[model samples]
Target: MVELSKARGSYVDPAPARVTVETWARDWLRSQSQLKPTTLVGYESALSKHIIPRWGRRSLSDIGYAEIQHWISDLSKNLAPQTVRNIYAVFSLVFSFAVRDGRLVRNPAEGIQLPRRIKAKRGYLTHAQVHRLADECGDSRTLVLFLAYTGLRWGEAAARRQRQSIPALRSLFMLSV
Candidate 1:
């Protein structure tokens, strides 16, 4: 009869666990290709330069509020408020995905406060400039005026049809013109 070695109280595996912040973030980005090209590029840039380096190796479940708070504090010291807020937004996406994937029970980003930034005043077209712009567009005058007045997005405005009535337009779309 061959003798067998006895096992310990509990079986233990020596393999290293694989879940990490970077992997989760990469998966999310890959899943978001439906977003605009510029938006995808922006996300990739933020992840490469900011979000990944700080929290990449951390397991999704291991992160907590205090850890995020410290990171936010440290970021505020070195980055402008707007930039820090953008960085935090990237972290928010990662944590949000973690919760959705069952990797984490809760999102650590939920209660973390972001630094507030004062936005620069926007520059509007002078009356003369607006008139000149409308004239220059010629056939496209209506589209330009519509964009400036109503704030309808470029895609939605471009999709409008000529036969669409004013009442229908008022309800289906608001004309900036």
Candidate 2:
């Protein structure tokens, strides 16, 4: 058999050099400094406080979906649902960066099913109830009246003058029943 050293062109192993997930994440974090100050700070904080301690040292190529799921499950222990979702967002962004930079063939976070968000319950008032409330309310209740009628916020109404309009907000309020 040919000597191992003679078979390869260099003294180093012929296998592709390994880049760990942590290193790739760090490199991505460094790239964030060029973004908005608040954005860079947010990314850096997420990386240091959340992503690094959990996933920093693992080999990028070896981090499969199971590991990611377990990490999310672990996060669920102490974090609120929205906070966990934010963690998922950071992971997705990092993996997307890895894919764009050619450090990863595919983003492992792409298809990992995140926890479903609990939607707020919306309650509607009947026409009679609305009329009774409006009759009892004064001019100061105009904002709430508008929220019930034209469905505009106090800010939106406050922001409005005769010459200006919010087309999108108008469109949303005017949707067909």
Per candidate, the number of residue pairs that clash is 1, 0
Per-residue alpha-carbon lDDT of candidate 2 for residues 28-49, written as tens digits (9 for 90 to 100):
7777765888877777777788
Against the true structure, what is each candidate's TM-score? Answer: 0.59, 0.60
Best candidate according to lDDT: 1
lDDT of each: 0.74, 0.70
Model 2 TM-score (2 dp): 0.60
In the predicted model 2, the residue pairs found to clash are none
What lDDT score is found at residue 44 in candidate 2? 71
The reply for model 2, stretches above 4 Å from the true place, is 1-23, 29-45, 123-139, 162-177
